[model samples]
Target: MFTSILVPVDGSEHARKALSVACQLARQEGSTLHLLHIPEELSHETTLVWGIGAIAIEASREERENAGKQVISRAAEAAREQGVTEVETVIGQGDPARTILSEAKRRGVDAIVMGSRGLSDLQGFVVGSVSHKVSHTAECTVITVR
Candidate 1:
C-alpha cells in the first residue's frame, strides 16, 4: 500500500538485503524507491578508539562517501531491474538516524525499509542502532530487514 518507500544504504550486507526487499515491495506496489546514503562523520573518539590516525580517518571518510555513491548507484540499478521504474538516490551528511528520519519526512515517503544493522555494530551496541532509533522516531511506517 505504500506509494513511496525509502531505503537507506551503507554498503553493508544487511543494507544490501534491505535494498533487495524494498525493491521487490516497490515493484509490487508500483511505488517509487528512494535510496539514501548517509556518510557518517568520523569522530575524534572513533579515531582514538580505533587507533586510526587523523589523516587516515580523513582519507577514509572521503573513500566511504565515494563508496556510498557506488552503493546508491547499484541499489538504483537493482530497483530498476526489479521493475520499480521510479527510483531516486541521495547522499546525506550527518548522523545516520537523523538524516534518515529527516529525509523520510522531507520526501513524504510512505514507509522506510532499512537494515537491522549497519557497518558499525560495536558503536550501535554502545549508542543504539540507527534502525532502532528510526523505528522509534519516524513518523511513517518502518520495516527493518534482517
Candidate 2:
C-alpha cells in the first residue's frame, strides 16, 4: 500500500495508461494521486492523448508550460473520474527524470507509476527513457506502463 503515488504525464497514450493504472492502485488503497507534467522541448509536432492538440517543436517555453498544465489537469481529471478522490496536479520544469524523482521525494510518495516512454521516443531510444532513469534512481517503488 502506497500512501501517495506520483504519475508523470506527458499527454502520451502510454502515460495515460499509466495514470489509469495508478488510479486503480489509488482506489484500492485510498491513496493520493499526484499528476506531474514536466515541460520538454519537443523536436517535432506530436499529437497528445487526452484529446490535447499537437505540440509544435517551434513552440515557445511558455507554450510548452501551458501544454504541460493541460497535461496534468487532464490526467487529474481522468484519475478523479476513475474514483480517485485525492488528486493533485503539478507543472514542473527541468530534466524529466530528475524532476520526477525530486517531486516524489518532495511529496514523500511511496511509488511512481509512469509511461515507459514519453513524447521523446526517438531521443529515449538513443539516450535512455525518463522512466528508465527514474526507476533506476528513485528510492520508491516504480511501475512503468508500456
Candidate 3:
C-alpha cells in the first residue's frame, strides 16, 4: 500500500538492516525508496567556542559527510538492484527524529521504515528513542525494524 518509503540511516548496523528491509519492501510493492542521512550539526562559532582545532574539526565534518554519502549510495544501489526505479537520497542536520519526520512530510511518504535499538519502556520514555518520537510525530505509518 506504500507508494514512497522513507528510511533513516545513521551508519549503524541496525540502520543498515532498516535499509535492507525498506529496499525489499519497495521492490515488492513497486514503491520509491527514500534514504536519508542526517549529519550532526555543528557551527563555526560553536566549534570555536569549544576550542576544537580547526583542521581536526573540518576533517571530522568531512568524514561524516563522506560516510553519509556512502550510506546513501549503498541504499541506492540496493534499490536499483532490486528493480526499484525511483530512489531518492537526502541529507540534513538536526535532531534525528525531527529531521526524519520533516523529510517524510516534505516527501509525502506513505510509510517510514527505520531501525530501533530495543530500549526498555522506562529508558525510552525517559531518554527517548528516535523511532518512538518519529512514530508519534510522523503523519504517515511508521515501521520499526528492530
Cα lDDT listed for each candidate:
0.82, 0.92, 0.73
Q: Which stretches of candidate 1 lie over 4 Å from their true place?
A: 41-60
What does the lDDT read for residue 105 in candidate 1? Answer: 100
Q: Whose lDDT is higher: candidate 1's or candidate 3's?
A: 1
Q: Which candidate do you rate higher for TM-score, 1 or 2?
A: 2
In terms of TM-score, the best-performing candidate is 2
lDDT of 3 by residue, 1-146 (tens): 99899988655556767877888888788898888888653322111111222223345877667655765677677668767888988888887788998899999999999988421234456779889899888899999987
Which pairs clash (backbone N, Cα, C closer than 3 Å) in model 2? Answer: none
Q: How many clashes would you count in candidate 2?
A: 0
lDDT tens digits, residue span 1-146, model 1: 99999999876778888988998888888898999988665432222111222223455777667666767787787778878899999999989999999999999999999999876777888899999999999999999999
Q: Give the CA lDDT, 0 to 100, for residue 17 in model 2.
A: 90
Q: Which runs of model 2 end up more than 4 angstroms from their true locations? A: none
Worst 10 residues of 1 by lDDT: 46-55
Candidate 2 per-residue C-alpha lDDT over 45-77 given as tens digits, one digit per residue, 9 for 90 to 100? 999998889999899998988888888888888
Ranking by lDDT: 2, 1, 3
Ranked by TM-score, the better of candidates 2 and 3 is 2
